[model samples]
Target: MDKRLSDYIKKVVTEHGVTSTLKMKLLLEVFLRQSIFVNTSLPPKHNKRFWPSLKDIYNHVAAQFLKLRDSCVDQKLVVEMVEEQRSLHKGERFYIRIKKDQEPGKFTDENFGMTKTEQSMKLVNILWEWPRMDLPINKGTGNIQGYNIATLFAKDIKTKLKEILELEEGDKRCYEPHWRHLQWIDRNDLTDHNVMNNSVKGMEERNKLFHEERWAEMSALVLEEFGLFKPKTIIGLFSPPGYYLSLKNCNNGKLMATLEDETGQRLNEGVRYFKDVLLVEARIIIASVVKNITYREAEELLYPLK
Candidate 1:
């Protein structure tokens, strides 16, 4: 993350009275701007996005999901997406108030003549300006020579999910989803056809790409203040709810923290393993922006050492 952006976010979260949801959203905004793909071989922030390794990626994604799942969705962008979908479906025109002296009551080409997909994508970019997720859409027409899109929603695993994005069982190719905002899905927007279009499909593929991956028994505590260096351990706060970062990952000889109370420091239950896995993913949070307490100090405060 950029230093300027990092300092700005820290000030926003620590000083301003913003909700945790907004704080997480601000993180997401920066996360999207980075080169998050694992296939890239570029240096960590060679003037671009950077996460050390796969473990860091999974941990970051899990942390983000947990934050979003636990927060309220009263964002203005969400409302605008919903209303824009409704208006587009109803074949309505938009009216804008410009700062300059403009002809009143005259329909301009400002937001006119946009196709359904184009119009929807226009609003979609407000949340994320990245390329939309490409899914093999079964259009039931002439598909590419060799293309197949499987199913997880249907019991038979063969039936086309008509209710979700109108994917039929037939010819198809990789297609961009009409709605790319997955955030809209969990916000009780499933009833709204437009917002719920390809969010489900995107999530299904994302689950396969991320949520279904194997655990490495480790944790990554991401912080902008720490820069490119990934912090692996934290002063675990185990009190009833299990607020703690695995001590085993503190091989770097120090524990880092992002919060004073250790309230939002931990991994999502989806990636947490206990039986055989040596460690589970957790976030570093406690005592100021990031206080790297020595291993001795960390162990004294740590509980039931991992």
Candidate 2:
């Protein structure tokens, strides 16, 4: 490291403590990782590979550091660093003076303006000096009801099915009952049918599609509302392995449609519709779980659907 840069880093380490140094180290690591991608020709967006841009990587690492700064560990580290610095400089006096004609990029060559290490240091400085904001009370640590949204979605399918079934049955029996109800129960009569075809299989299929679509839309909307676009944000979806399989199917269908070149746009639209709907439903469920309320209550709180 350049002497000036090393001294600057030492100053930051002394003043901000080990947490700040760790933040700087992490930033540099991300910068190095991003450099690997930047040097390569980027893969197509449709290629489901981890190839993030330098800016994207920087933003991600910076966000993580910000979160760390807000945590108790960071607070404790900062206190310890400050104390250590004070003890080390007990009799020394510190002073700051600005030199004329000293530019910020004085250390680096014009062609390679700022090195990644220097850039990382700058990012650390900004993070340390910038004013921080508290997350909203409702956001609640990006967790729902003490469980991750994805876990809830994956494990609580039975409960969800029961709720939807009960609701549907109530709607049919009490809200719109008629002589047709008898026909629905009989299953032998073909003259009249219930709204949902009067079979658990039929009802399950309908509920599955409904919940799937709802989960997609709700999850997407929640992500948008909360400004969570990273892969980690997908945890809010509460998706199971099967849910991912469905998403894979959607992607494969879209890819096939693209290859066909006919009905491609329509296929894309259908896939997008289902995916969005499922994500949104996941987000709603996550919010509900975190807020310790019913899914319906969460829907109303975030975005009411009448």
Query: What does candidate 1 score in Cα RMSD to the true structure?
Result: 22.8
- Specify the highest-lDDT model's number: 2
lDDT of 2 by residue, 1-306 (tens): 323333433444445533222245444434435744557664453432343343443344344445444443333344445657878999875433223344422321121234444533332222222232221222222333346434565565324422321221223221232222222222222222322234455444334333332333334333233211111112111110111111121223322233223222211222232222333344445665556777656444444222
Per-candidate Cα lDDT values, in order, are 0.27, 0.34
On TM-score, the leading prediction is 2
Candidate 2 Cα errors over 4 Å, as ranges: 1-142, 157-267
Model 1, 133-165: lDDT tens per residue?
Answer: 232223232111122111111121112111221
Off by over 4 Å in 1: 15-45, 48-154, 157-265, 269-306
C-alpha RMSD by candidate, in order: 22.8, 22.6
Whole-model lDDT for model 1 versus the true structure?
0.27
Candidate 2 achieves a global lDDT of 0.34
Model 2 alpha-carbon miss at residue 296, Å: 2.2
Question: Where is the poorest 10-residue window by lDDT in model 2?
Answer: 236-245
